[model samples]
Target: MADPKGFMRHARREWPRRPVGERVKDWDEVYVPGGVLPFVEQQAERCMDCGVPFCHEACPLGNLVPEWNDLVSRADWHAAAERLHATNNFPEFTGRLCPAPCEAGCVLAINQPAVTIKNVEAAVADRVWADGLAPPRPPERLSGKSVGVVGSGPAGLAAAQQLTRAGHTVVVYERDDRPGGLLRYGIPAFKMEKAQLERRLAQLRAEGTRFRTSTAVGRDIGAARLRARHDAVVLAVGATAWRELPVPGRALAGVVQAMEYLPPANRVCEGDLDVSPLSAAGKHVVIVGGGDTGADCLGTAVREGAASVTQVDIRVLPPAERDEAVDPWPVYPTVHRVSPAHEEAGELRFAQDPDADARLFAASALRFSGDGAGRVRAVHLGGVDARRRPVPGAERTLRADLVLLALGFEGPEVAAGGAVAELGVAVTRDGTVARDEEYATDVPGVYAAGDAGRGQSLVVWAIAEGRAVAAAVDRHLMGATSLPSPVTASTRPLRA
Candidate 1:
């Protein structure tokens, strides 16, 4: 600390987002371009540097929050970035997308607003990127141990980077035409522009991380063939089999899975299409789910010029404040917080459709109906109680020219014939890949990480697992290694 009284001296200030009226018309980051650095530095001083530092406990990567807070407060951007990178390989992605569980565990949060840790983290990343402090760190010597990292999402990318930096020749494989996985195709541009992802990928390339995009391991080349080329393999393919509604009219033309709808929409941003075939333009769009993916659809619908957009969630609405009784401090509490997408969607509904509420909590979708042309026309939904029991006379129909299912995923998908099934990987009851505490699968030289091994979870957890699995792979190849261990495959906060 710069100042012990910093939290008291300054009120929490957030980065200014562009005007809603102006931002909804385009697909770009919503925050104002510059001039917020001084404010970010000041916010960094709010860390109280507690006796136990519960922030570290809550963070999956065990990020050195107080250390970087001090460094940033002292205007040591380079050192701050280093400390940040020591734990997290991609702070920019976490800073933008993470729910900031560390902030929930902050010492200051007990009495007052927590230090704006997310903002400070993001600012340091942006600062280092602009000043050119982030550069390629190629290994001094080759370990001659080749590792094949399947999937190019956060987990795979992090594992490939760490393994490569440790002198191993790492090659990442992605089935998509371009790498970056969901980061490039699933997430909307307004949340995180693809440029940040691409910049880091270029650094990975310079550091000798080879990438083979548009090549599915089990499809393009046999799994045994892939294993033959590499000494070891890291399976980081994420949980992608989305949940579906089994109600009637599901086969209608306009009904699509969230992942299916989002990829083409993202491809439109990359200039692959002048207009997405699944575009919600001039249509009444209804999304089913209450999670971030649903909100992503909500924002995308607004940007696509939908006539109206609405979401129905079966779960009860989250409490405005943390539920101290059931979910005490140091845990990632389930609470209501508005996302950037909610802001855009809120404006769109308020301006375009005055009669509609953009989101419905304590509601469940019953069925769907189609028009004569075999296109989805309406969705039938009903209000639900705390236990998801239907409320009396609460059923209603909503206009839905385009229906998108933003429901959560159902663990790893292996049955439809992929690398996991091809390699004889064991799966848990919930459909996640089975691994030992060391993240080693039943196969001797093959390992797993991210959603594939851990089930569907947060990005921070994926990054931590990636780091841990890399160390395990390193040790397996070298007998002993010097890699840092952030977490084990089973490590996590209670109920986090």
Candidate 2:
């Protein structure tokens, strides 16, 4: 540790966000430039180097948190970056987007605020990139074996990078025009600028990983043909299916799914599209569901110049502060969180609590009423009780030009004409692709990872799974392999 008394001397300071009004005018990252580093070293010093180090257990990648924290505290930026890269393939992505469950599991969090592990990790990554310390790890010998990776998301990229470095020829296939799946298209630029992704992709290309974009398995090429051409195949297709509201009026013209809305906004940021087809400009937008996706929609609406943005959640509002009994220390808490989007948009409406498990609390979408012009005008809501039954006198109409269904995804979409169906892969009853211990499906030499195997989850989990699955594929291709598997399917954290 840099200073034994550092935690006592300096209070926790987070990265400062840009002024809401200023950030709303553009789709750039929310944080002000150059403000994060000043406090990062001190924050790293706060690590107590606990004997148990619960923070490690909390991370899916099993990142050497204390070692890196010590490195950062000592201002050994290069060493810290190495330690971070030892496990995580994309620290920049996770540092910006992950919820930071490791901080929740920090020993310091038993009472006081936890060390800013996430911020420190990001700082180390940025510093390494600036210092030109991050380099591609080209393999010492080409194994002559070839591997085909489907999907260009975190999992697919991570697996491809690892396999390529292990001396296997690797090819990545992405249906989108560009690589980086959600990283490139599904996520907004404000959360993480595209340049960061592009830089990583450049490094991957340098390391001899080949990318084939605008290609879909079972469509552009038959899945069997892909397997025949390549020695092995890895499927990193993410869960693209959005959990939809089956309630009436979902068919309204102005109502759209979160995935449909987010991509065009990202395209606009890429300068590929002049205007997003689903632009929220000049509209009274109401986002359903209060998860990260919803918050993302809220921020996007604000940037799109929505007349007003309101985010609604059926659950009773989470407490401003964490409740110890419900969420003990060293475990991720179910407390109120204020994301960058939440800060930019000042309205978050919590519907009354519902009694039944599936019932909507304070949730009501009675119907959609549109004008003769064929555009949406208003929405009808009924005050719902615990059972989601409409209250006798709680019916009300709200002006709404746009309704974004920000509800989360259920599983990977496998319907006809959908991405999964086009892939021609076998899926489980729950809709996820079936995979064995090595992440290989029933089809020989074919593998699956990320949301396609584990369902919807954080990016960190996807990266970890990718690394693990890559190791399995490498061993299968060669007689043996040495890639690290930081997490297993059985490693459960205190908090799910």
Candidate 3:
């Protein structure tokens, strides 16, 4: 360890977030610069090197947490980075965006605050990048097999890199103009700058992974033809079909889906768009969801100069502190979290809960009042009781110049009369694509991964599924494989 008594001497110190007012003026990451390394090393010393590390179990990718922590504690940055990348293909992405379930499973968290594992992981990745340690590792021998990856999100990219390094020719197809799917457009630059993604893409390109951007596989190329060309096909198309609010006045011009609003804002960061179509500037914005995506919208609105921003959630507000009975130690707690966006200009409203789990609950968007030009002016809410029956004298109207439906996604969109339908691949009752252990659908040689296989989830899960599916494909192609499958489709948190 760097210091025997480092943990005793120093408290857990994390990267400081930028001042809300200062960060709102630009699209840079929210954290304060250059103050993370020294503290990260100190935090690494907090690891007790448990007899059986549960942090590894907590992570779907089975990351070498304690080994890297020890390496980092010893100031062996390069070794720490290597140990980190041994399992995870994209530590940079996960370090920035993942919720850090690994920290939740830390042994030290039984009493004290968990070691800052996520922050240290990010520090190691940043150090590796600075040292130019990450280089292309192209395979020496060609397997004479080819693989096709549909989607350019985390899952697709991870699988593509692994498959390519295994001596198989890989081609990744992305429907968007750019290669990084949600990473390129959906995520705002303030969370993770696009430059990090571009650098990884450069490395992947150098490693012989070809990218075909602006190509929709099922639409542009026949699925049958694609299957014929490649020995195996991995579908990593993320769940893009957004969940929507079907309340009255949803058809209003000023109302739009959160995904539709987020992309243009990200595009603006790329200097590709002069103005986003769903700009939140100078409007009274109301975001109707309190998830991470909704938080992202809130932050974007504040930066875009929205006159006011209000985020509403139907569920009862989470406890400000962890509830031991409900959420024990070494598990992620469902406690209130103050995100950078929450620190910015926004009002978070917790809706009154309905006693019963009925269809509408105590929720009802009564109507949408609009202006003369058919633009939304305000929203009418009718409070209901346990059975969704309207409560007496609970009608309220809130001024809403722009309403964003930040209500998450459903599943991947199925194009009408496309290969998905033609092949008769099954869909679950919830509309997610059905797959077996190998991530293969009913049709042979066609596999699914990430959100396409599972529903909406964390980026860490996506990367894990990608790595697993790649191993399955490699095994199918070569009769056997050496690639690692760190996670399974059934793997989830103990509570989840």
Best TM-score among the predictions, by candidate number: 1
TM per candidate comes to 0.97, 0.93, 0.93
lDDT of 3: 0.83
Model 2 misplaced stretches (Cα beyond 4 Å): 347-361, 383-395, 416-425, 490-492
Off by over 4 Å in 3: 1-6, 346-366, 382-395, 417-419, 422-424
Rank by TM-score (best first): 1, 2, 3
Range of the 10 consecutive residues with the lowest summed lDDT in candidate 2: 350-359
Give the alpha-carbon lDDT of every model: 0.87, 0.82, 0.83
Q: Write one digit per residue (lDDT tens) for candidate 2, span 256-334.
A: 8888899999999999999999998988877777788888888888888887776666655567666888887877998
Worst 10 residues of 1 by lDDT: 348-357
lDDT of 1 by residue, 1-496 (tens): 6889888888888778888888888889888765468588778877777779989988989999999999998999999999999999999999888888898888888768888888888898899799998899999999989999999999999999999999999999999999897899998998889998999999999999999998887788778988899999999999997898898888999999989899888999999999999898999988899899998888888889888888777888789888888688768788876777777777656222242347777878888899898998988988899888989998888888988998888876697458788778889888888999989999878999999988878888888988889999999999987877788888866563
RMSD of each: 1.5, 3.6, 4.0
Model with the higher TM-score, candidate 1 or 3 = 1
For model 3, state the Cα shift of residue 215 in Å.
0.6
Worst lDDT run of 10 residues, candidate 3, spans 350-359
Write model 3 residue lDDT over 1-496, tens digit each, in one string.
Answer: 4565666776878888888668989999998865587578778988877888989988999999989999998889889989999999999899999989998888877777788989998899899898998988989988999999988999999999999999999999887899999999988999999988999999999999999887776678777778888988888888888987877788888888889899999999999999887898888887777688988888888889887676665555567776889888667888767777877653322112221111122445667888889999987777766455777897867678888887888887765655355445777887778998878887788888999889898899999999999999999999999999988776777473
Name the lDDT of candidate 1. 0.87
Candidate 1 lDDT at 355 equals 29
Clashing pairs in model 3, backbone N/Cα/C closer than 3 A: none
